[model samples]
Target: MSEADGIVYSDVKFTRTKRNTRGTTSSEAEPTYSEVRILKTHPSTELPGSQQHPVSNGGSKVTPERVVIVVLSALLAAAVIALGFTSLDNMHTKQSFQTLRDELEAVKRNLTERHCEVKSYNTVQQTSPQPPVVKENDPCLKCERGWEQDGRQCYYFSIDLLTWSESRDKCRQKGGDLVQIDSRDEQTFLELKVREKMKNDGDMFWIGLTDSEKEGTWLWVNGSPLNERLTFWSASGPDNWAVYNPDGEDCVMMGKKAGAPDLKCWFDEFCKYTRRSICEKPAETGHFTLQCV
Candidate 1:
């Protein structure tokens, strides 16, 4: 018998045969016996009268500790993959944010440049000198050939004598009316101009003032009542004097007299009295046409 891994097996057998010890003369021995021995390399190897054992792969047995190690390794690998994806997503997000920031900066720079340009243009416009505007057709120079212009108005001095009514009609035919003196400046101007045209104290020019409607209520020819505060009546006239004729003088005239009070040159007379007249109109403004005689 032999031993292997502390396991051994033995076989014993008995056989009946002719005795051969005497070479052909003696009968077989009374009985013959034979013995056999079996050996095994390890106890786990299956034997005729031994219990079976669990098999192993490549002579290596599996253990619970190794299985746990393998499962843990699988989980770690999955975690690493998930972390990699998360990192990639974070990187992409950061890039997108950076790109947006760059775009915003560019837009801000463009807007700032445009604003500066506009400011510079406005400054140039404000600082540059501009030429003065001159009107092509000045109203001050618009008087006709025969009419005399004075302060935006034109005057026509008549040479023929006529009644007050006839004189007003003639002035209307020339697109004007008898002069209405508004200010002391105008009154002074008329005084100086009439002083140049006077032949004698009796020679006078009929103005557009009358009191023919009532006894003493004077009014301009345009129907507005006279401003009594600005009248230029002589010191001792407008007395409704009835000495010269039965009817009182109701028309007004302007003239220069010797030794007269300063700016006192107005006198009342009959409407039927004939006298030269002074006509007036506003200077042309090109808005409408005035057909003058």
Candidate 2:
């Protein structure tokens, strides 16, 4: 193989022997040698005046282009895997957040329903005595289903018989206190209502007035002094009667009389005596809604 002319030459030899006329083989033979030169161009090398061709190494060698492509492919596959994992994690996070939000909303609603009037029922409102502010004809007044609405007040006449303390407890459970007769009209309203519902002459309803703190100075359940002008003691008297038991008559009750004058129904009695009683609360205003139990 010559690089200058891009030719490849090879030598091959052949041997010949002279035969006798009678076709007998001769033992002595003379070998003749001849020089033969054949010119061929190499398939892989470039000729002097022709274009150059690429060399091949049986596909064993790696090129720069192939190395770059392999590296890029591996990087792309890794990126795709990472992206899939990130997307899955985000989906789980979103689902967890939504579940927590729903739980919070349910708890908030339950709190609102159960605690609507708890504070109002526990705290007593102290106010000076004044003329009754009636709103019986107002459009915004609202009350519970079984309660009677008068002016801005709702009254619940309980049928269950309980002691004075027990009756106040029951009223507090219903989001109210015992009825506070603040005016002549209120006393008259209660008198007429009790008269109609009386089962017999002994039937009566307990009022909120009490004189247990002192012998003579009476106070309402809300710690307010009884009004001197609004006295409704029975015609017979409060008397602080103690004939039945030793505790004396400290609590008051209102009973129906066959021909008693209006607002003349109140009587001082033993606090341990069980009787039907009345409860009273202000009507719900526009600011907040109260769910009475």
lDDT for each candidate structure: 0.75, 0.78
Give the per-residue lDDT of model 2 (tens digit) for 1-293: 44647544555555677689999878766666666655665565755788766887577777999999999999999999999999999999998998999899768655544544422322322231232243454334456779886656889998999999999999999999999999887787788888888888788898888999998889999999999888988787689888888889999999875876577888888999899999999876332333334
Once model 2 is optimally superposed onto the true structure by TM-score, how far is the C-alpha of residue 226 displaced, in angstroms? 0.4
Segments in model 2 whose C-alpha atoms lie over 4 Å from true places: 1-139, 285-293
How many angstroms is residue 29 displaced in model 1 relative to the true structure, after the best TM-score fit?
99
Please name the candidate that would achieve the greatest lDDT relative to the true structure. Answer: 2
TM-score of each: 0.49, 0.50
Alpha-carbon RMSD of each model: 27.5, 21.1
**Candidate 1 global lDDT:** 0.75
Best by TM-score: 2
Candidate 1 C-alpha lDDT tens digits along 54-144: 7656677679999999999999999999999999999999989989998997686455334321123344445544422324533222355
